[model samples]
Target: MIAPVENKPEDVPPAVVDEEEAEDGEDGAPETQGAGGEGKKKKKKKKPKKKKLEQTEPPSIGLSRLFSDGNYPEGEIQDYKDDNSYRTTSEEKRYDERRMMEDIDETYNNIRKAAEAHRHARKWARKFIRPGMRMLDIADGIEDAVRTTVEANGLEAGIAFPTGLSLNHCAAHYSPNPGDTLVLGEKDVLKIDIGVHVRGRICDSAFTLSFDPTYDPLLEAVRAATDTGVREAGIDVRLGELAGYIQETMESYEVEVNGKVLPVRPIEHLSGHTIHPYQIHGKKSVLLYKNEDQTKMEEGEYFAIETFGSTGRGKVVEQGEVSHYARRADAPHVPLRLTSAQNLLKSINKNFGTLPWCDGTSSGGGEQLNHLVSQGIVQDYPPLCDVRGAMTAQFEHTILLRPTRKEVVSRGDDY
Candidate 1:
């Protein structure tokens, strides 16, 4: 079971131990005694035994160890490894398996690095974000932090997708456009979904923020639902069964808004998904509610276990201007008449590749990009929203199904 997040302990540096010095006389000279009254002899004094320092559990791994060297700390072994069945009887098979394990370890390191970058960036966002801030500023601040921390250059390492700052009824697929003037309100519930990638290994995780106390139950419901999904997820686990657990945990809470008691409902349409290299959404989908889909999670798969809870209608519809777009991984070759649209497609391929991007990151807005969308060359993701008056909340974490055990790579001190 995944342990619940707790308050982190303060960092304490290791104590410095100084070398013991030899005893000296009052005159600052070594003590000496005459031997048989013939010549002066040096005297040795017994030195006091040094006290042993108390040992305590080491601090959990954080960005410093991740960035400096890809070594996970002692306490983080469980978070990375879950099983130990790699031993074999055949020497040849053992050699082959060792090579395979080396590749797997490298992959895990890349994913964990991205996960650490995401955790650090979002932790900063949680502290820096507040009401009355412009949506553009918030997005810039987060993306900048991720890029800076990851030292993103080209496609090697960078932001996996556009920073999602969906608010109020908006559940996902929302980010500030280039000139968007939307400002956060104190009553709005904001979902900050962040993605980071190292060499195409993406760490996709998110959390909801509400400034008002009335929505505490709503946030708690979504967070607990996400936690349930992460805990229940493992090798050979059925997606439908996992969704049932998430739904049960989510629907158990109720929030009162304006004297009206509203039961938090799981948004059935929005589901978690498996992640692939350079692909945010893989083929398999992890539903948020009970369903007939019996897809079993296999080993060596990365999944983003996310859940959405709402106080209004449990269903969400795409209802807003399109701000998010991505080049289709399987985009077919098609002829384009407009040169501007063709140029925009080239720019997207050269810059964003298969990752989702917003208008702020891409150039040639208006009909040029729309033309590409119409041609099916690009997929546009509009804001997903519930009812206008209702509020929505979401929480997400990425997990890896290793051969030995499941690793919650995106797990952090703060969720």
Candidate 2:
């Protein structure tokens, strides 16, 4: 259930939009002491852990596996406000079900406001972001900006998935390690992902911004693909149709840019997922692959249409970040600090969604979350699979599906 495209508002600059496409694994470093010169001479103490090696992932997983629904870890949710009487689903009792849905809609509206504010914060920060900056610093900026915006907007709390600062070739989890000499070079592609929660509902979103003027073609290609996908995302269109349309448009741009039929990677595993209130990457998925079930788009559903066109062969590999992948709610239960994770678990069936861990490298709550399905603790959705190369771009929009029309919940001036 992707949103329909509106007339590109004039206030919104003429631009491109598109698709693209997670994880965390980290080795802890020991503490270190600084050297000191006392009186005449004093030696410096030894440093702790060495910088982490650049992780190399395995060869590309076949296209078939990339698009498989099973590729993502899934969780279940079993808890909700019992006394509130806001979540009741009895097929036989239509009136009761309608009432429950109404409550959900009211609660979801609150969630949407929080999501919009969260996005506005990110957009505000984009003005200061540019080349020759530290990826870690940018991540920090996002953290600060998002936190400030969420609070000012009266939102309770939120979390950013892969609050990534991935540059060229680094599909995700590219935030530099401590002491690693990493800096954004000219013409680099940076992907930023963020999430927020309001009144227990969650919204997850991402944007890939480029600083290299030379890569404008790549950006434009992604934009065209994104526009094509968004334009085709309608109330009656099938889910696969968006993917198919994006694939077609991206291929055309691939040839025009490279002067050859360059194979644009259509990350099959990175298709958009459904969102319910505060929970993201929900049970249903809008697949890039052709699935009979996903062939029909329905009204009243929501979807994020993401597209990715890579410079390398259109193939991507997993890179063995299963540790970065989220665990299933049925997997096991563990304590976490991410407010979004907790709320998501409650809404998704505590057994349906897993808390995320960022390879445990960065300092943040719920760096990764685990759940026990049988115990009704949590479950994992298919986290994103990493792409193979450095040059990749993505675009996305959150939309509400109506019977005959759609509304972009995250519509902004830049679009």
Candidate 3:
């Protein structure tokens, strides 16, 4: 709901008053006789009139203005909150109801703050990033920008997960390890997936960057698919139907590389999922291809509506060394024989909790991490890659399905 506009007393102009007054006379009475005993009229002192205040339009309170670069698609904003249309009967309750210790407005503000941090960091990264830069430097730059923008302190607010700088065939889950010497090339297609959270409310979004115009179509396809997903999504929308719309929009475009036309395909296995508090991946998954899953999106849920378009095989497989790891949310308590493993687990719990962390963020504990992985106390995520010599691009936006409207929390002008 839009707040009422109030005008302070200082904002109003003072009233102008005109009164006839005689010099040396009380209460504006004219002197009957002058010093020469002749009746004369004294010149009246005039009060300057105050000009009327100019009328200008009030500042906009639309949701689009919340972010500095927010560009939500048409009709994304609704006034259900003002009209009390968000209320529903008990029988029609959604699967996931809104649960928070604070008020709903405060919750939205927290989420928007996190989204703004992500937007500002990404904006700086997009401008500062260039070819020939090391992947490690790029990741560090983005993460550092996020930390600075959010003013993160401990777990109250910080990076939701490790920044993914997957390039070319590597579709996702690729972040550079410490001392790794992978440099970005001019021809490479880089996918930058960044996450930020405020008080456990995560805003997960990603975009693709390509230096060459030859891969423009690939980027466009993925961005269009993501936009389609965001536009088509709403309360009570079926996940399978949403997938169909995304695939239809994504597969409609083709790119030309070296005079060879290649149709962009949606990555079938890599699907977008819901985001929960302190957890990047929730239970529900949104596929890129058409399916029969009858799960309907409920109100009061946050979703990462992401899509990956590729010019290679539509499916991706795990490859390369594991760099991303996270503590299992439901990890079983198992006695560890090695003290290093126990220490590493303690560090992970204290520092990262269940959020994903990369090797770059860790402090040289490969053996202990391996031991934790063996015990299933931690889960490892290797880089996901398509076929060699292929190119993939991804675009994502986090959305909150409010009772009144769906908020594209991560919507920015860049993507």
TM-score of each: 0.81, 0.60, 0.79
The parts of candidate 2 lying over 4 Å away from their true place are: 1-105, 152-156, 173-181, 255-263, 289-295, 320-327, 332-390
User: Considering summed lDDT, which 10 consecutive residues are worst modelled in model 3?
Assistant: 54-63
Judged by whole-model lDDT over C-alpha atoms, candidate 1 comes out at 0.81
- Candidate 1 wrongly placed segments (more than 4 Å): 1-66, 70-101
lDDT of 1 by residue, 1-415 (tens): 2554643323323242222223454332455567666544345556797653321112123344344555532112232213333422446545654564589547777787788777668877888899999999999888887887676877888889999999998899999887899999999999999999988989999999989999999999999999888877877788998899999999999999999999999997999999988899999998988988889998679899999999889999999888889999988899999998889888998788899888767877688988888888899999999999889998998987765556778888887
- Give the Cα lDDT of each candidate: 0.81, 0.52, 0.81
Candidate 3 lDDT tens digits, 9-87:
4564545222332143544446668677987656556679765332112211222234335432321353233223554
Best prediction by TM-score:
1
